[model samples]
Target: MAFFRQLVGKILKNFNDRLSVSAAAALAFAVFCVLKAKGKPKFPFVNLSNFMLVLQKKLVEEVIFDGSHILFRCVNQAQWHVTQAEPMIRGKELFKSLVQYRCQFK
Candidate 1:
């Protein structure tokens, strides 16, 4: 029990550090937005399908599938990592959706 508590504390500390870094980056981005609001060129609008297509091409460099979760590594030198928990639904719909998206994109 003591070991588990220490492990969880370390994990939370690491997560908090990462969150602070992300917050700083987000602040910098907001500064850029404020500057760009002054007579800057408008960015092109992207719809969900187009955004999904772009993500399909560049977002996931590798996928590590575990029993009930997935880890996705982006193509940016392992800088961006995402983990998603599997949805609880009848008939393995999450797996089916992934296959269907793969086929559709192909």
Candidate 2:
């Protein structure tokens, strides 16, 4: 997404006559970016910034992420109870361990 935005920005910057790059910064962690078109009568200030990457999930009986931790992974009706989770950059998860799982669902 960021790459596509940047690519478009570059094309618009070099070839666009009346296209002024407009951008919005999300409240979540994000990177705001803009085009840098030099040699203009007035130099254009184009910087890109994107704040955060979020992956929200809804489980069988509840909406997750309301709390600060992920207790389990709900794939369909199956819940892989997460006993341990490894930390990653910016609180993103890439690894987890579920040693023991118990579920009784009707």
Candidate 3:
């Protein structure tokens, strides 16, 4: 996803007419958006005995998953970063992101 995003950024930079450039570049941009798959899990290793242990509370609240989009409210923060908001992941990725988000406190 990052590769495609950087590639699209490079592609967009070559175009002279930014306003009327809706040809091949537009299709490439569309393809980049479509590549938003549920990426691999990014959680840390945990011992078998401590698998159910939670170190921190959830930062996000009231998650709503209605098919395509996942909407959720964020808790108060000193700085509103990407972790404060939902990453548009579904099912497994959602769980991974939730874990990653809460793990910041630990």
Candidate 4:
């Protein structure tokens, strides 16, 4: 149809003029962020138990650690300092004791 053709032409013309994916512009924005923000120091971790203990200690108040992760939280607070810190934070003793309890026969 003539109406459809005209509508499609107008839409494609606008898109061609407006759309952009400039690497230089993206690189400039990234550089601004790197210059503006100071990042946190990374922690050396071997296992979940040690990681969880350190994270719990950093919180403003006590936080309950589920076997695999932290529970629902409050508004002013966040659980872990780092995104990858969760699975690494499990309590070794608690987990060991749980496993023993499950395996032992009465």
Candidate 5:
């Protein structure tokens, strides 16, 4: 009976240790997420409508295309950047539209 009790106690101790370790890991992850969310500004997705608005409002002053990233300076003096994950065709379409819009204004 004593041996059985000892075995059960050891099992419970091991389970408790694992539970504490898991809880600590979860807490750390939650803290990291909170920090990340607080630091980042949420920008609107880059699409046709947004691009049109940028053009219509003359919000974008300069646009820089670097490989998979597009960086632009707004009239408000704020700079915004986006990394494109879409296919090359979509990027080409966006570039064409931007050029068309700029040509119209000029």
Candidate 6:
């Protein structure tokens, strides 16, 4: 009887330890998600209509003039600077600009 009681106590203690570790991990993940979400900007300017307008403006500019290396350098610097913004829209904007500007020269 004593041997069975000891085995049950050991099992219960291990299960409690696992549950505590799991709870701690879950809490950490939730905190990380909240912080990451908080860093995102709720910008209304990321709609499809505005995106099309930006594309049209770029196309017009490209048609009117040849590409400049200075423009490329400035854009690269801008990308490096703005990469710190954790917002998805900012990331998309940076990617779009890099592709449009670099592709024109290449």
Pairs clashing within candidate 1: none
- Which segments of candidate 1 are over 4 A away from where they belong? 1-55, 88-100
| lDDT tens digits by residue: candidate 4, 32-63 | 67756756545332344544444344422433
> Which RMSD values do the candidates have, in order?
16.3, 16.5, 12.7, 13.4, 10.9, 15.1
Worst 10 residues of 5 by lDDT: 81-90
Model 4, CA-based lDDT: 0.45
Model 5 residue 76 lDDT score? 69
User: Model 1: per-residue lDDT, tens digit, 1-106?
Assistant: 5864674465556555866666655655675676578664433343435434544665556654554544444566544333334444124466558535754663
> Residue 41 lDDT in model 5?
79
TM-score of each: 0.33, 0.16, 0.24, 0.21, 0.38, 0.26
TM-score of decoy 4: 0.21
In model 2, the runs with Cα more than 4 Å from the true position are 1-63, 66-68, 78-80, 83-86, 89-106
What alpha-carbon RMSD in Å does predicted model 5 have with respect to the real structure?
10.9
Candidate 5 clashes between residue pairs 3 or more apart in a chain or in different chains: none
Give the number of the best model, judged by TM-score: 5
What lDDT score belongs to each candidate, Candidate 1 first?
0.52, 0.30, 0.49, 0.45, 0.62, 0.42
> What C-alpha lDDT, on a 0 to 100 scale, does residue 29 get in candidate 6?
69
| TM-score of model number 6 | 0.26
Rank all candidate structures by their TM-score, best first, as comma-separated numbers: 5, 1, 6, 3, 4, 2
In candidate 6, the residue pairs with backbone N, CA or C atoms under 3 Å apart (3 or more residues apart, or in different chains) clash, namely: none
